[model samples]
Target: MSILYLVKKNDELISHCKCEESLVGDPGQLDCPWCGCGWLFSCTKCRKAFTFAEAKEIDKTWEELAREDLLGYSGKEPELEDINSWIDCMQNMVSHIEAGKTYIYLDGCFIPADEENFEFEGWKSKHNFYKTPQVIALKDKDIIDEVLSNPQYWEENIIQEQ
Candidate 1:
């Protein structure tokens, strides 16, 4: 079954976004292919965008999930000191975020946990099926506005009917 997100306001459900594995194409991918919401949800009722900050109000566990996904991390768990270094790197990248550049989540996974182990016979074949990390880029502001205004996006049949 797909993961279904419920958007609520005043304790009432207002809208939902279901992350279907088939539609998502990649299990490890962060964004919803159908809506491109990327963990953010736009309520069909009040039109409010549900963000990670808001998610914290509903469930505190979302804080960790947000950190790991947005800040990026290596495939294998890092040591305490390594974590501090990675945090510094991520912070620096955050300051330099800009338009037209692709930001990849989980990009560090390309490096195997143990390079030597990967050289063993059949190891590559065993792990080759892993889903690739996902990426998102901010285009020019005017171009973004133009795409947002496209009527076809909001058409009833743009995504397959559930």
Candidate 2:
């Protein structure tokens, strides 16, 4: 799996990049990909690059604090519950990344990602392309459920609804 690098300014996500490993390259050498104004620094915990100056004021790196916030590390092996919570948090983060994109429904319906004008016309409107809708009308629910539950199915069956 690839590591993700994120740069935040005032608690808002500004830039992000995917790296194969920790970007422990020379500090002050790389530029922030998102803003292009700040210099990149390696995060000690995740080894990812970020450009934040507040980290120095606190005598702690921003990446270290971010990891502590996300992972909840107490210098011990995390319990199963903690791991599960972290996983859920990461999933929510990924979902936020896709929050503003147009999504296609299972019934070949198009839904814009605008919250202000959004409307739930019917039950079919609740499901998006990333999440499979329950087809209770089908007689063979078991087979459909198994197929939909598989990640490979979503990867292979991405429809381009116009």
Q: Tell me, by TM-score, which candidate is best.
A: 2
lDDT of 1 at 143: 27
After superposition, the stretches of candidate 1 with alpha carbons farther than 4 Å from their true spots are: 1-77, 97-162
lDDT of 1 by residue, 1-162 (tens): 212222221211212333221011111223222243322233322233322111111232322323443333334444556545544543332343332222221211222211232311121111221221121112233422232223342242233334
Residue by residue across 46-150, what tens digits does model 2's lDDT show?
A: 444332212111333433434454442245555666556645543333332232243222222222222232333221122223222222213344634344334
Candidate 2 wrongly placed segments (more than 4 Å): 1-49, 52-72, 98-162
Please provide TM-scores, in order, for all candidate models, with all chains considered together.
0.20, 0.24
User: Which residue pairs overlap in candidate 1's backbone?
Assistant: none
Clashes (backbone N, CA, C under 3 Å), per candidate, total: 0, 0
